[model samples]
Target: MKKILSITLMMLAFAAGTSAQQLEKLFEKYMEDERFNYVYQKKPGMVERLNDAGSPDLWVFEKSNASLGRRMLTLNGGEKSLEESFTREVETALKADKYEQVSIVRNGKNRVETYEKITDQGIAKVNFIKNPGNIMVTLNLYAQKK
Candidate 1:
Protein backbone atom coordinates (compact mmCIF):
# COMPACT_ATOMS: atom_id res chain seq x y z
CA MET A 1 0.00 0.00 0.00
CA LYS A 2 2.77 2.47 0.83
CA LYS A 3 4.62 1.83 -2.45
CA ILE A 4 1.46 2.24 -4.45
CA LEU A 5 0.65 5.57 -2.79
CA SER A 6 4.17 6.88 -3.39
CA ILE A 7 4.07 5.90 -7.03
CA THR A 8 0.74 7.61 -7.52
CA LEU A 9 2.02 10.83 -5.96
CA MET A 10 5.11 10.81 -8.14
CA MET A 11 3.05 10.42 -11.28
CA LEU A 12 0.83 13.30 -10.28
CA ALA A 13 3.79 15.57 -9.67
CA PHE A 14 5.31 14.77 -13.05
CA ALA A 15 2.02 15.44 -14.79
CA ALA A 16 1.66 18.78 -13.06
CA GLY A 17 5.18 19.83 -14.05
CA THR A 18 4.55 18.88 -17.66
CA SER A 19 1.37 20.94 -17.79
CA ALA A 20 3.06 24.01 -16.39
CA GLN A 21 5.89 23.81 -18.88
CA GLN A 22 3.46 23.40 -21.75
CA LEU A 23 1.57 26.52 -20.73
CA GLU A 24 4.73 28.55 -20.59
CA LYS A 25 5.82 27.29 -23.98
CA LEU A 26 2.47 28.22 -25.46
CA PHE A 27 2.68 31.77 -24.16
CA GLU A 28 6.19 32.22 -25.55
CA LYS A 29 5.29 30.99 -29.01
CA TYR A 30 2.34 33.35 -29.16
CA MET A 31 4.53 36.32 -28.34
CA GLU A 32 7.23 35.42 -30.88
CA ASP A 33 4.85 35.04 -33.81
CA GLU A 34 3.09 38.28 -32.96
CA ARG A 35 6.34 40.22 -32.93
CA PHE A 36 7.68 38.63 -36.10
CA ASN A 37 4.56 39.45 -38.11
CA TYR A 38 4.53 43.04 -36.91
CA VAL A 39 8.12 43.62 -37.97
CA TYR A 40 7.75 41.77 -41.24
CA GLN A 41 4.74 43.85 -42.18
CA LYS A 42 5.77 47.25 -40.91
CA LYS A 43 9.46 47.98 -40.80
CA PRO A 44 12.15 46.61 -43.17
CA GLY A 45 11.04 47.79 -46.61
CA MET A 46 8.82 50.68 -45.58
CA VAL A 47 11.51 52.42 -43.58
CA GLU A 48 13.79 52.51 -46.60
CA ARG A 49 11.07 54.04 -48.71
CA LEU A 50 10.45 56.70 -46.10
CA ASN A 51 14.16 57.40 -45.87
CA ASP A 52 14.62 57.68 -49.63
CA ALA A 53 11.83 60.23 -49.76
CA GLY A 54 13.92 62.37 -47.33
CA SER A 55 11.56 61.51 -44.53
CA PRO A 56 12.89 61.40 -40.98
CA ASP A 57 11.46 57.93 -40.39
CA LEU A 58 12.62 54.40 -39.71
CA TRP A 59 11.25 51.65 -37.51
CA VAL A 60 12.40 48.28 -36.16
CA PHE A 61 11.46 45.93 -33.31
CA GLU A 62 14.13 44.16 -31.29
CA LYS A 63 12.96 40.81 -30.01
CA SER A 64 14.08 38.98 -26.92
CA ASN A 65 15.81 35.61 -26.87
CA ALA A 66 13.09 34.09 -24.76
CA SER A 67 9.49 33.45 -25.59
CA LEU A 68 6.75 35.63 -24.07
CA GLY A 69 9.27 38.39 -23.65
CA ARG A 70 8.80 42.14 -24.06
CA ARG A 71 9.86 43.19 -27.55
CA MET A 72 9.93 46.81 -28.77
CA LEU A 73 10.89 48.55 -32.00
CA THR A 74 10.95 52.26 -32.61
CA LEU A 75 10.49 54.41 -35.72
CA ASN A 76 12.27 57.71 -36.19
CA GLY A 77 10.87 60.55 -38.25
CA GLY A 78 10.47 64.32 -38.20
CA GLU A 79 6.71 64.32 -38.51
CA LYS A 80 4.64 65.94 -35.82
CA SER A 81 2.70 62.71 -35.47
CA LEU A 82 3.17 59.39 -37.22
CA GLU A 83 -0.02 58.05 -35.68
CA GLU A 84 -2.18 58.23 -38.79
CA SER A 85 0.43 56.73 -41.05
CA PHE A 86 1.07 53.88 -38.66
CA THR A 87 -2.62 53.11 -38.39
CA ARG A 88 -3.17 53.17 -42.14
CA GLU A 89 -0.26 50.88 -42.85
CA VAL A 90 -1.26 48.33 -40.25
CA GLU A 91 -4.87 48.42 -41.34
CA THR A 92 -3.94 47.87 -44.95
CA ALA A 93 -1.72 44.91 -44.14
CA LEU A 94 -4.35 43.35 -41.91
CA LYS A 95 -6.99 43.90 -44.54
CA ALA A 96 -4.82 42.06 -47.03
CA ASP A 97 -6.24 38.89 -45.44
CA LYS A 98 -3.35 37.29 -43.64
CA TYR A 99 -5.11 37.15 -40.28
CA GLU A 100 -8.67 36.51 -39.14
CA GLN A 101 -10.84 37.86 -36.30
CA VAL A 102 -8.60 40.91 -36.42
CA SER A 103 -9.22 43.75 -33.96
CA ILE A 104 -7.77 47.23 -33.58
CA VAL A 105 -7.63 49.57 -30.62
CA ARG A 106 -6.77 53.24 -30.40
CA ASN A 107 -6.97 56.02 -27.77
CA GLY A 108 -4.96 54.04 -25.27
CA LYS A 109 -1.71 55.33 -23.81
CA ASN A 110 0.03 52.70 -25.87
CA ARG A 111 -1.54 53.98 -29.13
CA VAL A 112 -2.47 51.54 -31.91
CA GLU A 113 -3.13 47.87 -31.15
CA THR A 114 -4.24 44.81 -33.09
CA TYR A 115 -4.67 41.07 -32.78
CA GLU A 116 -2.92 38.77 -35.23
CA LYS A 117 -4.80 35.87 -36.78
CA ILE A 118 -5.41 33.00 -34.41
CA THR A 119 -4.19 29.74 -35.86
CA ASP A 120 -4.26 26.13 -34.82
CA GLN A 121 -0.83 27.04 -33.54
CA GLY A 122 -1.54 29.99 -31.12
CA ILE A 123 -2.34 33.71 -30.64
CA ALA A 124 -0.57 37.01 -31.38
CA LYS A 125 -0.81 40.54 -29.92
CA VAL A 126 0.68 43.64 -31.57
CA ASN A 127 0.90 47.25 -30.49
CA PHE A 128 2.26 50.35 -32.22
CA ILE A 129 2.52 54.09 -31.62
CA LYS A 130 4.37 57.33 -32.23
CA ASN A 131 6.38 58.45 -29.25
CA PRO A 132 8.66 61.46 -29.18
CA GLY A 133 11.14 61.05 -32.07
CA ASN A 134 10.14 57.51 -32.90
CA ILE A 135 7.25 55.16 -33.51
CA MET A 136 7.31 52.23 -31.11
CA VAL A 137 5.95 48.83 -32.07
CA THR A 138 5.55 45.71 -29.99
CA LEU A 139 4.36 42.13 -30.61
CA ASN A 140 3.37 39.27 -28.32
CA LEU A 141 2.90 36.01 -30.25
CA TYR A 142 1.86 32.60 -28.94
CA ALA A 143 2.26 29.44 -30.98
CA GLN A 144 2.39 25.77 -30.04
CA LYS A 145 3.85 23.11 -32.27
CA LYS A 146 1.84 19.94 -32.54
Candidate 2:
Protein backbone atom coordinates (compact mmCIF):
# COMPACT_ATOMS: atom_id res chain seq x y z
CA MET A 1 0.00 0.00 0.00
CA LYS A 2 2.83 2.40 0.80
CA LYS A 3 4.52 1.69 -2.48
CA ILE A 4 1.33 2.29 -4.38
CA LEU A 5 0.83 5.61 -2.63
CA SER A 6 4.37 6.69 -3.43
CA ILE A 7 3.93 5.84 -7.08
CA THR A 8 0.68 7.75 -7.27
CA LEU A 9 2.27 10.80 -5.70
CA MET A 10 5.13 10.62 -8.14
CA MET A 11 2.77 10.43 -11.06
CA LEU A 12 0.90 13.51 -9.87
CA ALA A 13 4.11 15.45 -9.47
CA PHE A 14 5.24 14.51 -12.97
CA ALA A 15 1.91 15.50 -14.42
CA ALA A 16 2.08 18.88 -12.79
CA GLY A 17 5.59 19.46 -14.05
CA THR A 18 4.77 18.46 -17.61
CA SER A 19 1.59 20.51 -17.67
CA ALA A 20 3.54 23.62 -16.70
CA GLN A 21 6.16 22.96 -19.32
CA GLN A 22 3.79 22.47 -22.24
CA LEU A 23 2.63 26.09 -22.24
CA GLU A 24 6.16 27.36 -21.71
CA LYS A 25 7.41 25.30 -24.63
CA LEU A 26 4.66 26.68 -26.80
CA PHE A 27 5.62 30.21 -25.82
CA GLU A 28 9.28 29.64 -26.53
CA LYS A 29 8.52 28.14 -29.92
CA TYR A 30 6.65 31.21 -31.13
CA MET A 31 8.02 34.14 -29.09
CA GLU A 32 10.81 34.83 -31.54
CA ASP A 33 8.85 34.26 -34.71
CA GLU A 34 8.56 37.39 -36.80
CA ARG A 35 4.88 36.86 -37.32
CA PHE A 36 4.14 36.83 -33.59
CA ASN A 37 4.45 39.53 -30.94
CA TYR A 38 5.38 38.41 -27.46
CA VAL A 39 5.00 40.50 -24.32
CA TYR A 40 6.08 39.37 -20.89
CA GLN A 41 5.56 41.48 -17.75
CA LYS A 42 7.67 40.59 -14.77
CA LYS A 43 5.58 42.69 -12.44
CA PRO A 44 2.89 40.48 -10.99
CA GLY A 45 2.26 43.20 -8.45
CA MET A 46 1.03 45.42 -11.25
CA VAL A 47 -2.17 43.47 -11.35
CA GLU A 48 -2.55 43.93 -7.63
CA ARG A 49 -2.20 47.66 -8.06
CA LEU A 50 -4.75 47.61 -10.83
CA ASN A 51 -7.08 45.72 -8.55
CA ASP A 52 -6.56 48.31 -5.88
CA ALA A 53 -7.39 51.03 -8.37
CA GLY A 54 -10.74 49.42 -9.06
CA SER A 55 -10.52 48.07 -12.57
CA PRO A 56 -13.54 46.49 -14.22
CA ASP A 57 -11.62 43.28 -14.77
CA LEU A 58 -11.45 42.83 -10.99
CA TRP A 59 -14.01 40.07 -11.08
CA VAL A 60 -11.42 37.75 -12.50
CA PHE A 61 -8.60 38.87 -10.22
CA GLU A 62 -10.58 39.08 -7.04
CA LYS A 63 -8.99 37.76 -3.86
CA SER A 64 -5.82 36.98 -5.76
CA ASN A 65 -2.17 37.78 -5.69
CA ALA A 66 -0.51 37.56 -9.08
CA SER A 67 2.85 36.20 -8.09
CA LEU A 68 3.81 34.58 -11.39
CA GLY A 69 3.78 37.60 -13.66
CA ARG A 70 2.04 37.73 -17.06
CA ARG A 71 2.81 36.81 -20.62
CA MET A 72 1.06 37.46 -23.88
CA LEU A 73 1.70 36.15 -27.36
CA THR A 74 -0.06 37.69 -30.29
CA LEU A 75 -0.09 36.46 -33.84
CA ASN A 76 -0.99 39.03 -36.44
CA GLY A 77 -1.35 38.79 -40.19
CA GLY A 78 -0.66 35.10 -40.34
CA GLU A 79 -1.88 32.60 -42.89
CA LYS A 80 -4.94 30.55 -42.03
CA SER A 81 -2.83 27.44 -41.65
CA LEU A 82 -0.46 29.18 -39.23
CA GLU A 83 -3.25 30.67 -37.20
CA GLU A 84 -4.97 27.29 -36.99
CA SER A 85 -1.76 25.62 -35.93
CA PHE A 86 -1.18 28.15 -33.15
CA THR A 87 -4.73 27.76 -31.93
CA ARG A 88 -4.34 24.00 -31.85
CA GLU A 89 -1.13 24.29 -29.86
CA VAL A 90 -2.73 26.64 -27.36
CA GLU A 91 -5.67 24.30 -26.94
CA THR A 92 -3.35 21.35 -26.42
CA ALA A 93 -1.27 23.19 -23.86
CA LEU A 94 -4.33 24.27 -21.89
CA LYS A 95 -5.67 20.75 -21.94
CA ALA A 96 -2.35 19.33 -20.84
CA ASP A 97 -2.33 21.84 -17.99
CA LYS A 98 -5.76 20.61 -16.92
CA TYR A 99 -7.21 24.08 -17.31
CA GLU A 100 -10.98 24.44 -17.13
CA GLN A 101 -12.83 26.74 -19.46
CA VAL A 102 -14.57 29.21 -17.20
CA SER A 103 -16.18 31.51 -19.73
CA ILE A 104 -16.43 32.34 -23.39
CA VAL A 105 -17.73 35.52 -24.97
CA ARG A 106 -18.27 36.32 -28.62
CA ASN A 107 -19.28 39.55 -30.27
CA GLY A 108 -19.38 39.74 -34.00
CA LYS A 109 -15.98 38.74 -35.32
CA ASN A 110 -14.26 38.91 -31.94
CA ARG A 111 -14.24 36.02 -29.48
CA VAL A 112 -12.63 35.58 -26.06
CA GLU A 113 -12.15 32.33 -24.17
CA THR A 114 -10.95 32.13 -20.58
CA TYR A 115 -9.40 29.08 -18.92
CA GLU A 116 -8.26 28.61 -15.35
CA LYS A 117 -6.15 26.08 -13.44
CA ILE A 118 -5.33 25.99 -9.77
CA THR A 119 -1.74 25.14 -8.95
CA ASP A 120 0.35 24.71 -5.83
CA GLN A 121 1.61 28.25 -6.05
CA GLY A 122 -1.53 29.94 -7.32
CA ILE A 123 -4.29 30.05 -9.86
CA ALA A 124 -3.33 30.31 -13.50
CA LYS A 125 -5.67 32.00 -15.94
CA VAL A 126 -5.49 32.24 -19.66
CA ASN A 127 -7.28 34.68 -21.88
CA PHE A 128 -7.41 33.73 -25.52
CA ILE A 129 -8.74 36.37 -27.87
CA LYS A 130 -9.51 35.79 -31.51
CA ASN A 131 -10.31 38.48 -34.02
CA PRO A 132 -10.75 38.59 -37.75
CA GLY A 133 -7.08 38.10 -38.60
CA ASN A 134 -5.39 38.03 -35.25
CA ILE A 135 -5.00 35.63 -32.33
CA MET A 136 -3.75 36.55 -28.88
CA VAL A 137 -3.02 34.37 -25.86
CA THR A 138 -2.37 35.85 -22.42
CA LEU A 139 -1.29 33.92 -19.32
CA ASN A 140 -1.73 35.23 -15.78
CA LEU A 141 -0.94 33.53 -12.46
CA TYR A 142 -2.42 34.54 -9.12
CA ALA A 143 -2.19 33.26 -5.57
CA GLN A 144 -5.36 33.31 -3.53
CA LYS A 145 -5.52 36.11 -1.00
CA LYS A 146 -5.12 34.74 2.47
Candidate 3:
Protein backbone atom coordinates (compact mmCIF):
# COMPACT_ATOMS: atom_id res chain seq x y z
CA MET A 1 0.00 0.00 0.00
CA LYS A 2 2.81 2.37 0.89
CA LYS A 3 4.54 1.58 -2.41
CA ILE A 4 1.34 2.26 -4.32
CA LEU A 5 0.87 5.62 -2.63
CA SER A 6 4.46 6.64 -3.26
CA ILE A 7 4.26 5.70 -6.91
CA THR A 8 1.08 7.70 -7.30
CA LEU A 9 2.70 10.73 -5.74
CA MET A 10 5.67 10.42 -8.08
CA MET A 11 3.38 10.32 -11.08
CA LEU A 12 1.44 13.35 -9.85
CA ALA A 13 4.62 15.33 -9.34
CA PHE A 14 5.85 14.55 -12.85
CA ALA A 15 2.53 15.50 -14.43
CA ALA A 16 2.35 18.62 -12.32
CA GLY A 17 5.66 19.77 -13.81
CA THR A 18 4.32 19.28 -17.32
CA SER A 19 1.07 21.00 -16.40
CA ALA A 20 3.06 23.98 -15.15
CA GLN A 21 4.55 24.40 -18.60
CA GLN A 22 1.37 24.04 -20.64
CA LEU A 23 -0.77 26.30 -18.49
CA GLU A 24 1.74 29.08 -19.01
CA LYS A 25 0.65 29.31 -22.61
CA LEU A 26 -3.00 29.54 -21.62
CA PHE A 27 -2.14 32.31 -19.18
CA GLU A 28 -0.37 34.26 -21.88
CA LYS A 29 -3.37 33.91 -24.17
CA TYR A 30 -5.69 35.34 -21.55
CA MET A 31 -3.35 38.28 -21.11
CA GLU A 32 -4.16 39.28 -24.68
CA ASP A 33 -7.86 39.72 -23.85
CA GLU A 34 -8.71 43.35 -23.03
CA ARG A 35 -11.36 42.75 -20.40
CA PHE A 36 -9.02 41.86 -17.58
CA ASN A 37 -6.53 44.30 -16.10
CA TYR A 38 -5.78 43.35 -12.49
CA VAL A 39 -4.17 39.99 -13.03
CA TYR A 40 -2.24 37.84 -10.58
CA GLN A 41 -0.71 34.49 -11.42
CA LYS A 42 1.19 31.87 -9.45
CA LYS A 43 2.76 29.06 -11.38
CA PRO A 44 1.96 25.48 -10.31
CA GLY A 45 4.55 24.89 -7.62
CA MET A 46 4.48 28.50 -6.47
CA VAL A 47 1.26 27.68 -4.68
CA GLU A 48 0.98 24.91 -2.09
CA ARG A 49 -0.11 21.50 -3.30
CA LEU A 50 -3.85 20.84 -3.45
CA ASN A 51 -4.86 18.82 -0.41
CA ASP A 52 -5.16 15.23 -1.54
CA ALA A 53 -5.47 13.12 1.60
CA GLY A 54 -7.56 15.80 3.18
CA SER A 55 -10.89 17.02 1.88
CA PRO A 56 -10.91 19.22 -1.23
CA ASP A 57 -12.68 22.53 -1.10
CA LEU A 58 -13.93 22.00 -4.65
CA TRP A 59 -14.32 18.83 -6.69
CA VAL A 60 -11.44 17.63 -8.86
CA PHE A 61 -11.60 18.37 -12.60
CA GLU A 62 -11.68 14.75 -13.79
CA LYS A 63 -8.83 12.89 -12.14
CA SER A 64 -5.95 13.59 -9.84
CA ASN A 65 -3.19 15.93 -11.10
CA ALA A 66 -5.74 17.62 -13.35
CA SER A 67 -5.55 20.99 -11.62
CA LEU A 68 -2.23 22.79 -11.24
CA GLY A 69 -2.43 26.55 -11.81
CA ARG A 70 -3.97 29.57 -10.10
CA ARG A 71 -4.87 32.96 -11.54
CA MET A 72 -6.79 35.94 -10.14
CA LEU A 73 -8.26 38.56 -12.45
CA THR A 74 -10.33 41.64 -11.81
CA LEU A 75 -12.78 43.43 -14.10
CA ASN A 76 -13.12 47.19 -14.34
CA GLY A 77 -16.55 47.59 -12.82
CA GLY A 78 -16.46 51.37 -13.06
CA GLU A 79 -20.00 51.26 -14.43
CA LYS A 80 -22.68 48.85 -13.28
CA SER A 81 -23.80 48.02 -16.82
CA LEU A 82 -20.24 47.48 -17.98
CA GLU A 83 -19.53 45.10 -15.15
CA GLU A 84 -22.63 43.04 -16.01
CA SER A 85 -21.65 42.94 -19.64
CA PHE A 86 -18.12 41.86 -18.85
CA THR A 87 -19.41 39.19 -16.51
CA ARG A 88 -21.79 37.86 -19.14
CA GLU A 89 -19.06 37.84 -21.76
CA VAL A 90 -16.72 35.86 -19.54
CA GLU A 91 -19.41 33.36 -18.56
CA THR A 92 -20.30 32.79 -22.19
CA ALA A 93 -16.70 32.24 -23.15
CA LEU A 94 -16.33 29.68 -20.41
CA LYS A 95 -19.15 27.67 -21.96
CA ALA A 96 -17.78 27.85 -25.49
CA ASP A 97 -18.32 24.89 -27.82
CA LYS A 98 -15.11 23.00 -27.10
CA TYR A 99 -15.02 23.26 -23.33
CA GLU A 100 -16.90 20.79 -21.14
CA GLN A 101 -18.52 22.02 -18.01
CA VAL A 102 -16.95 20.00 -15.20
CA SER A 103 -18.76 21.27 -12.13
CA ILE A 104 -20.19 24.28 -10.41
CA VAL A 105 -20.64 25.10 -6.73
CA ARG A 106 -22.36 27.98 -5.10
CA ASN A 107 -21.49 29.66 -1.84
CA GLY A 108 -24.29 32.07 -1.08
CA LYS A 109 -24.28 34.58 -3.94
CA ASN A 110 -20.79 33.59 -5.10
CA ARG A 111 -20.54 31.10 -7.96
CA VAL A 112 -17.60 28.89 -8.90
CA GLU A 113 -17.49 27.24 -12.29
CA THR A 114 -14.98 24.73 -13.58
CA TYR A 115 -14.50 23.68 -17.17
CA GLU A 116 -12.09 21.42 -19.06
CA LYS A 117 -11.15 20.89 -22.70
CA ILE A 118 -8.83 18.28 -24.17
CA THR A 119 -6.74 19.46 -27.07
CA ASP A 120 -3.61 18.26 -28.83
CA GLN A 121 -1.59 20.30 -26.38
CA GLY A 122 -3.22 18.81 -23.25
CA ILE A 123 -6.26 19.09 -21.04
CA ALA A 124 -6.98 22.70 -20.08
CA LYS A 125 -8.84 23.23 -16.82
CA VAL A 126 -10.29 26.68 -16.26
CA ASN A 127 -12.12 27.85 -13.17
CA PHE A 128 -14.20 30.99 -12.86
CA ILE A 129 -15.35 32.67 -9.69
CA LYS A 130 -18.01 35.35 -9.59
CA ASN A 131 -17.92 37.29 -6.39
CA PRO A 132 -18.72 40.84 -5.40
CA GLY A 133 -15.15 42.12 -5.31
CA ASN A 134 -13.71 40.60 -8.47
CA ILE A 135 -13.57 37.64 -10.81
CA MET A 136 -10.90 35.01 -10.26
CA VAL A 137 -9.75 32.33 -12.67
CA THR A 138 -7.49 29.42 -11.91
CA LEU A 139 -6.34 27.60 -15.03
CA ASN A 140 -4.78 24.14 -14.85
CA LEU A 141 -3.27 21.64 -17.26
CA TYR A 142 -3.70 17.90 -17.31
CA ALA A 143 -0.85 17.03 -19.61
CA GLN A 144 -1.24 13.25 -19.44
CA LYS A 145 -4.91 13.07 -20.23
CA LYS A 146 -6.16 9.74 -21.48
- Give the number of the best model, judged by lDDT: 2
The all-Cα superposition gives candidate 3 an RMSD in Å to the true structure of: 13.6
TM-score of each predicted structure versus truth: 0.36, 0.78, 0.54
Q: Model 1 off-target regions past 4 Å? A: 1-71, 80-86, 97-110, 130-133
Model 3's alpha-carbon lDDT is 0.60
lDDT for residue 73 in candidate 1, whole number 0-100: 48
Candidate 3 lDDT over 39-138, as tens digits, reads 5434444234444224454334334444444565555443567667656756655554256788899999889888878776666767777777566666
**TM value for model 2:** 0.78
Model 1 lDDT at residue 136: 57
Candidate achieving higher lDDT, 2 or 3: 2
Residue-pair clashes, model 2: 0
Q: lDDT tens digits, residues 1-146, model 2? A: 99999999999998888776688788889889999999887765655556644865765565446455779899998999998888899999988878899999999989999998887788888899988789999888777677
Clashes of 3: 0
Ranking by lDDT: 2, 3, 1
Superposed by TM-score, candidate 1 places the C-alpha of residue 116 at a distance from the truth, in angstroms, of 3.4
lDDT of 2 at 125: 80
